[model samples]
Target: MTVTATKFTPEVMLSAPRRSPGVPNPSGKLVLYTIRVLDIESGNSELLTEDPEAGCPVWVGEEKVLYLKTDSRGNTTFIVRSVKSPEPESYDIGKINAPLSDLKVKKLPSGNIALACSALVNPDGELVNPETDKKPLSSAKVYTSLFVRHWDTWNSDRKRSIFYGALGEEDGKLVLLGNTLTNALGGTNLSSPVPPFGDSADFDIGPSGLVFVAKDPELDPATYTKTDLYFIPLKTFTEPQAPAPRIIKTPGLEGYSQTPVFSHCGTKVAFTRMHSRQYESDKTRLILVPDINNPDVTEEFYATEDGAGGWDSRPEAIAWGLDDSHLYVSAEFHGRRMLFQLPSTPSKATQFPKLIETPKGSVVGFSVLHRPGSETTVTTADILFVSSTSLIDNSCYSIAHPGTLECRLISSTSKEGKSFGLSRSQVDSIWFSGAGDYDVHAWVVRPSTFSKDSKKKYPLAMLIHGGPQGAWNDSWSTRWNPAVFAEQGYVVVCPNPTGSTGYGQDFEDAITGNWGGRPYQDLVRCFEWIEQNMPEVDTDRAVALGASYGGFMINWIQGQPLGRKFKALVCHDGVFSTLNQWATEELFFPIHDFEGTLYENRAAYEKWDPARFANEWATPELIIHSELDYRLPVTEGLAAFNVLQAKKVPSKLLVFPDENHWVLKPENSLVWHREVLGWINKYSGVEEEQKSN
Candidate 1:
């Protein structure tokens, strides 16, 4: 069969069907994932449902599946469909008081299926329905707390919490028990599933109880990342009074607690915990509670002989082996998100995790597939179904054998890269000596039409990643995609410098209070390496782009000697001044990164302040910020643009009123790409070719 390759444009990337993590059925014969079902053995896939508003598909039992479908009017319906039946059974849950999402279900011991979903509720634990509930005549919001506003929105009297009810059958019709849903966190004045990015992963439901993570209400949310794990015992779906949730304390581990997974038997729980309260980028240690009934007895599985000498990579997501003897974890390694396996039980001797060899690209998520009757055994039949993506592929699923440590491709979004004119060969990397004489890794993505034998050279696009602690992983991304830039006739180079994760803790810690020091020098060396080594890259016609901390670097670069190297620059939601960063929502981020509060450590902030060196800013730049970006705030972008305009430097400012830290909406994303690419291309001379075409 002959297939035609197409240019991977912004529209193509945006219009592509998004693939979500899938859940496997109890039998493991079929996978209920990505709005489709795949027969594992036959390798045949069929759409299970279709709708832009449909999501959160979960398996109810071996033969049944449940999901939620919301209409344009904001009304949600609970859908239950049998694998054998042609039609699905749906019950109108009616219009929730707030936005309802993150559906989870667990079959109770009494044969009743308990359903839990998250939504906003008032301080009194009553559902907060902006559409149907009464509101004061004034639109003004008064807040006396630290978090008057969060990531993108202003704080209200309502908080995001979990609501629970039983899915039952009455008179041959599926219905919600008690004809109403009760807030699982009712009367607690606590919000489960933390804000902004938290989802179903923040809480898990088991036969015995529900486990969730919530920030300590007494602490200021803006300053502390301390969230405790809480367990709520469940007996009846409809209880007269919801039992007060008990905090599962992990002594000496007070940072962010996340991803609580219940053992298959519901007797134990496994989660990840960080040690520091202020640093959000601390190493996540795998934590295990052998007995849920005795929550105080917690064990740290991957601890070092001393306190800080052992494994350094932060575990992102974790899953347990079917037998619960082994735990599977995914963490950033070098530049890839690698999967590792470790014994679930604590060891007397120093122990390290074993690496599981998987396909190229990072493992986004995975599900343990246990064959029928093999749930209690560590057999070869048990497969870890992993979902991953790379710079070339949007989605790919592979079946990994735990025993052999071998991975085989099962299916992908498309047959091959030919479908989108992308190839794995075009994705390459290099290691160079950077600041501090340490080896720094950088990914180099060449255009699909790139050829070393050809006389043509491609313009250089230097892409910087955010997190400052985040690395440019070998993973797919819709926003700030290197492929998008490479396809535009630019050789995209993304450097994982100091402060980047996947390296060691000391490397990541080097960025603390040295935001513009080592990392900036690393980028300078990376640019020089490409210039001196790659004859196919036109470094003279180069452009640099970044967002968040990366954006901060662009602003920082505009004042350094490196500013003269870039032909053009793009800063998305970057910091304008280190001292003014106190206006950000998450104070802990700047506090920890800068080493202390602004008042307590004014010199640290002043040392790295980009505004201090604004006199050297002469680069033609494009500044992008969103009105809702509480993390960096719109003022940061405006402040940078103001300085540029005052100096009469060629510059443009683009602001999205509706977006937060990212341009998420499809239409908005298209505009973002067009403006950013057009600006950079014009300065890099690629615009002339585009105009002629």
Candidate 2:
């Protein structure tokens, strides 16, 4: 039976990943945005910039601020403003003659700027702006041997490169010095900041003016793509210069290494390093490469041997402590992204890193205000600013300091009291005995009309999360939102089953080569627990739905011995044939998860291949697939639909030609929500009750 959550459960929890398109800015007319600074000591805030497009502010000394301003015509210029003077001057750090599409700009320590952009340059170091180029994309002939097609974009010679130089005298003029870092060999075909997709954090410009960069290692096709660290001296970036990179060798790390960050003193570098060369799920260990007159000495910085002890220990953002002895590392744990303060060097006395108290939600991005010579720093104080969000709210900004109980909220995304006609759902935590008697945690969202004493029993919608390595956390989701089901008068159950993150290392690794084993049992037991114990649920009219790995589980569930537990099932972008998915985009994921190639481990592939057991399928199902979904090719979804149709199990196929793995478009998402809910309503008769009420 489907049961709604009680009132007492607690609530909890993308990074430099280009802010998802779904993120909402305030809905209004074009209002000019101004940069404002708040003083913590005096609780006073003053305007810093009045430019409408001023954003991505970076602190330049004590009283100077550097920010980017983009105009209506897509022209961008960096502005350096002073705060100490009565009339702060805005220094026009003019535009670089490069495509501003997905551009990134960082203020270097030496009063210069480093830009990463997609540009076409001549041998003479002049930018050939595509908008004004004689040959446009329609007329240009593009050729590439590797990564011809990435996540979405087609790669040609117009890949991204790093260019460092100062602004010229003209308002928007750029001075070109050295050649593009990624194009030194005529064309390295390498993406820097690390493409298909990457951010400023992927590379670092140290205080010493040397650029510590990370990119796919130039290797033959036989080897898996491995990212390594390289040193690019700023001095070499002169006229007629070639981009020279000195590779930093890590003896123990054979896997990919990115996110290279240098310490405040520039004597050490910290980056996430994985060990296994070919495994995608390999544990990333945070290591400190000390500058002891050698580029090869890399030592573990965190106390834990395997690092943070979850699905992936690789923290996305790492910041140094003002003292330079500790680092604030952010990683996903138990469905929530948490921040921990760990020492720079290993310590026998400290066994575990300390978790800094944060709002019980995801910490997306943060900036630290070191204030080196300030009064508080004179006595040693920790000061930080964070941007975070929860299920009920959009992102908000806050300030965390030494004296605060929690980070103090400085600004909120929502208006002070304006209601947006959005209703908050009641979500509660539930724990039940899963496979092997392990305690499995899941969340239940109650319909707005549900009451503990009410006689009305609601049908349940079991929502399985995608990442076999991911978890359903206490966070808001645009896709697979539990609130949507709740709004449709169905109680939603989201379980952090086996192999889900935030549990521990062992639990996450359990489903590695045994995909259809314990994780499926965890879902079965989670379903059974709700049916037997919860009196407010209509268990007999439940529908199971999943996407990605969760979608794989939905297919597996239809063939299980207790497959009759659910009335219907919906699988979106699921894997039907494990063997057939070998050609999927990420070769390393399935290779490592299934343990070797499909031929090498035929038994492993057959054990989890849902298509093999189609004869056992009896439940009515709906299959959804997108053409652009490279991770799980659209063929898997089509094959699953073919089986359901052949067996006459009553199925329908929903396909999106333009969308990728996710139904990200606004209209498509609306259709997805309606169709999936409509299928459940048709089978379970839940919509009739809503209409009658």
- lDDT (Cα atoms) of all candidates against the true structure: 0.85, 0.65
Query: Model 1, range 507-540, lDDT digits (tens) per residue?
Result: 9999999999999999999999998999999999
Among these predictions, the greatest lDDT belongs to 1
476 in model 2: Cα distance from truth in Å?
A: 2.4
Candidate 2, which segments miss by more than 4 Å at Cα? Answer: 1-93, 101-148, 153-158, 167-189, 210-225, 235-243, 303-314, 347-349, 371-380, 402-405, 414-425
Clashing pairs in 1: 97-129
> Candidate 2 lDDT, tens digit per residue, 1-693?
012223211121011111221111112101111366544444344577666676655444445555667665445566677655468766765564444433344445554545433334554444546555565557555554444445554444454455554322234334332322333323344445665556566667554434444545555322365677766555323323435566777666767676777777766788877777775455677767777235667776543454443323556677776667767777777667777766667542154666766665677766556453543352125666666655444444566663345667655443210121223446676899978868998888877667888898889889999878888876656677676676677888999988887776678778888889988888888888998888787888999999999999899989886568788899999989888866565666777788878778888888898888889999999999998887787898999999899988889999999888788886787778778988888888877875887
Tell me the RMSD of model 1 versus the true structure.
2.2
Report the C-alpha displacement of residue 543, candidate 2, in angstroms. Answer: 1.5
For each candidate in turn, the TM-score is 0.96, 0.81
